[model samples]
Target: MCGIVGLLVKEPELRESLGALVVPMLLGMSDRGPDSAGLAVFTELLENCNSTGVVPSITRKYSLYIGQHQIDWTEFTHNLQQIGNAIIKENGNHAIVVSDCEPNLLKQWIKQHYPQLHILSTGQTIDLYKDAGNPAEIIDRYQFGLLTGTHLVGHTRMATESAVTPAHAHPFTAGEDFCLVHNGALSNPYSIRRQLEPQGIQFETDNDTEAACRFLEWRMREGDDLETALQTGFEALDGFYTFLIGTKDKLALVRDAFACKPAIVAETDDYVAISSEFRSLAHLPNIKHARIYEPAPEEIHVWMV
Candidate 1:
């Protein structure tokens, strides 16, 4: 199994707290996955002015969860103009666009109408980084900690069922603010992918992890809350996997029907933590004591931090 870690905090200080908490976790689980490492941080944007002097500007964070696709940026901007009042900002292979409506509402609308499009990670603050090779190398190359956020999810991949590449790495994003990193295999990912294709869901890679992200998007459009979506996913899909999903407002960990994967969850008054191994929790200072348990088969464990 691959190693996974997730954290959420209300204070900015938690950014350091999370880095401190996860570094050793990644180090400890290093052997489980030596091919690639990635992390996704989710936070809300504090009031700040942009270089363009736009106040209350909306920013977006994205991850590799969305497949890389080719779209004409110029045409995309023209279309945004037709959508009424909106602002668009582009970042490294990603875009930070906003509309007159609430970001969450706008995200929901996009999911409902453009399910097939890969629009990974939204919100005022979101960042996803992954690279080919070990976690330490990837972190060093990207300066992972320099990025700030309130919630973070990370993974180290061992490449059990898929090839090793940056694009296939963990922390896959479905849209501007939704991302998921998985640590197990979906036994029947192709079948589920087929089911979603008819709904206009598209996949850039052949990995089943992308299918899971699309599944979440589809469930969210069906009016299912995060918990409901996860629980429903456990029943609807055939697989043995554990997922660590991050949204702007919530962080969730879900187990497959058989609990074939290993996951450990620990929470304190100040924060919540999940990892693929217990030793990964060794670095957490505030975790004086931890209640470690594996998720039950077909069970969903959700924490809204």
Candidate 2:
């Protein structure tokens, strides 16, 4: 079994308050998985606006702000290349970097394509930390409380079938943008692995969670949105699982058809929190009256800022 927790803070300042909320909850779950622990925190920011009528200052650095403008990374890069010097860097679904361009031009491009995406925080906003160890040890070593952001998802793992190593730790990351932690098994991982191997998808560890990641990546390549890809996974994949997945923009919680594992989710005006056990949210300062619910069998719950 594994432990999973998530928090979505509407206000940036509330992120600082989440550390105290998460510490006890993670500790309460130590018995579920003692081999490893991990957390993914996401935030958004706006760069300083400039008078040049160039790209908005907020759109200059981190792509999360630009994402709010809904500019397609691929299309934006193509546009950038046509007019001026630009470089792009991508890590899974989380990031896109464009350098040496006019901020106003970038903003205009984003406004044209993606007007619905919102910018909530900025600058080095998302963080992923994981290691092979117990929750307390990992938190202490990582100083988890110091990490402030708009949202976070955390996990603790106890390897049953997989080897005990950092490579197999929860919050298994693909590039710098997406990570996932899971409880339970995938019935047909080998078949999936065989199919993925030839397509240049590498497997660093034999854990089924890694296979799930690859599966998601494949669906994304096939033109599926994150939620659609995961929903399709419920039909195409056979398994028993409860997954806590994190990307630069969202947190997804899913359970298999049987709902063989356990998970709990709670939401408040200021934040939304989820975990494998109830105790995880016991200490939240704003939780005067907390309602806990479980995901329906074969259900997927996604939270975004």
Candidate 3:
């Protein structure tokens, strides 16, 4: 079991509070899932990064060490600078590296030299943060109140079928500007993983949620619209699930045919929000006047900015 919450700020004014507003919703669902929690916030490109308004490139990579380990971060970062201009921001044991080099190359170099450091996610607008702890503590540690973004998705995991490692966390990124959080299990993740491996899609964890992430990324690569890709998931994926997918400008919610898992969506002029339960969204600003409803089984809700 897991807790999932998402927010799409329709009003520009609310974007600045996107992270602060979603923290309570994430915490409210903590009772449903308390083993660990994670979140992905889709914010603007870093002020130092270049932008073409299209063909977006990942400008930052979030990574961390496996355990109590130490390396000369200054020297390691200096090596990174040899490749291209870069900035490294350290937070506790994790670090967010902003660099001009391709994210794939940066990740590859880090893996090759510092095998202990594991990358979490990379994207221009998407920054993923997660850990094996309570949702409220994680939020406080990250100081979520300062996070500003157009939209965000979060997950608190109960670790039903996977380890509590950071790599096993939700809000898995499968492609540039794309990531997903799931609340349920996939019945046939192995077969699907095998089929995807040959396609050059990689698996970072045995979690079925990761398989679902790769599947969607592959479908979009084959020229399917986000909706079409999710529709195809209905045919290919066999399970009870509710998925909250985040992209650069859109947040999508989808449920399996059974819809055994719970999901509630609340919409208003200022923002659109989703949660595993109603109480999770109860504390939002101006929520009293919001239009609240539960998404039907097999129904898809896509909110675009």
Least well predicted 10-residue stretch by lDDT in candidate 3 = 49-58
**lDDT against true structure, model 2:** 0.69
TM-score top scorer: 3
CA lDDT of each candidate? Answer: 0.70, 0.69, 0.84
List TM-scores for all candidates, in order. 0.78, 0.73, 0.93
137, model 3: CA deviation in Å? 1.6
lDDT of 1 by residue, 3-69 (tens): 8888776445676556656677777776888898888876556333234455444433323222355
lDDT for 67 (candidate 1) = 32
Off by over 4 Å in 2: 45-125
Candidate 1 clash figure, as a count:
11
Q: Native-vs-model 1 lDDT?
A: 0.70
Better of 1 and 2 by lDDT: 1
Using alpha carbons, what is the TM-score of model 3? 0.93
- Per residue, candidate 3 scores C-alpha lDDT tens digits across 12-82 of 99888888898889889899889788888888656463344333344564545334567677888778776
lDDT (Cα, tens digit) per residue for candidate 2, span 175-294: 335667788888888888998899888776798888887788688777898899899889867888888877777888898888898888887777788888777777876676756688
Please provide the root mean square deviation of candidate 3 (C-alpha atoms, Å). Answer: 2.6
